[model samples]
Target: MSQQTKSDYVDDVDVDDDWDDHPTDDELEATVENLEASGFDVEVVSDAEEALDVLVSEIPAGASVMNGHSTTLEEIGFDDYLGEGDHDWENLAADIWSIDDDAERDAARRAAQTADYFLGSVNGIAQDGTLVAADLSGSRVGAYPFAAQNLLLVAGVNKVVEDVEAARERLHEFAYAFENERAQEAYGVESYPSKELVYRQEGTEGRTTVVLVEETLGY
Candidate 1:
């Protein structure tokens, strides 16, 4: 995964008119520092492999792990890893999807909100250290505020924005569109942000960890 400049994603990053402008290395450094200062433990990795390694080693072997629909995770091979990789932790998503009954499957998905570890991605991250995410339902973001014991978010650097407002714009312009397209194809309906979560600051120490990768991943 190359550290593509903002120019590379000129057509895709629609956080706003100027939101597509990618930050420089200095801006990235500042963003990391700002993120850490705001109480989010941050990890700066160069590529998807490093990001996967971080997830594999940081999460305990037997700690129940779960994740939602994330293209970034898919791109990094995490979906397959959680399903097929040798590990001791329970993969809740697999469990939720395995149920033969639709009603039971929906229940399991809700139950997963309390998993030992909840993993997901964000729509955008602000330089001020705020995280912005949206979903058709609150199933994923619902765990971030209080449901999960520990939370891990894997995001590509392309998500970093200049400010909180830009973060929201990115979600509306880019993330929502990308997801709506996927939803229409997958479920025969368009998707919108039925539920939104803005992670302000984590009060607990070491409870929420964010892995920031340098490559262009996700919407």
Candidate 2:
């Protein structure tokens, strides 16, 4: 399947004009430095394809993989790749969704958080190295903070904010409206920022990697 592009739904929602601008080179450099100092490995990619390539190459064969719902992931083709593309890793998302029993499926989701690799995207990333993310459910941000063995977050440069407070503001004032429209269009329901996560630092070294793409993507 072809990857879903931002152009499909971007025009349908009201995105904050302030949130759409990419960071300056100096800003990007500072963000990267702070992220690395906070114990996350940083990867800067020129485009979505390179971001997808880096994401794919980070995990080894036979590793168990799971991901939360992320428009950014879909934009970069990771969702389709993990679901239908040729890959050697154990795709836990596929397995969990195939279950017939609701109870079992819910249990699988909780357990899958500890998969060898957990991938998703954040709503806002502070220049000071803080990451802000929220979801209608805790499915995505839940795995980001120590639940997963390894975390891989992919985001556009537009997500970078001035500080943690601004990151949080961006989540509600900027990302939520766009995400709400997306939820309505795709699932026939509205989305809310029900659960939030503010990631300041990683205690374990090399456990998380943030891939920042040059192009704007997702909410």
Candidate 1 clashing pairs, residues 3+ apart or interchain: 15-170
Residue-level lDDT tens digits of model 2 in 1-219: 344455666687676687878889999999999999999999999999999999999999999999998889998989989988489999999999899999999999999989999999998999999999999879888999989999999999989989999999989987888778777777799999999999999989899999999999886
The top-ranked prediction according to lDDT is 2
Native-referenced Cα lDDT, model 1: 0.83
Where is model 1 poorest over a 10-residue stretch in terms of lDDT? 1-10
RMSD (Å) per prediction = 4.3, 1.7
lDDT of 1 by residue, 40-63 (tens): 999999999999999888889788
Candidate 2 has its poorest 10 consecutive residues by lDDT at 1-10
Query: Candidate 1, TM-score vs. the true structure?
Result: 0.89
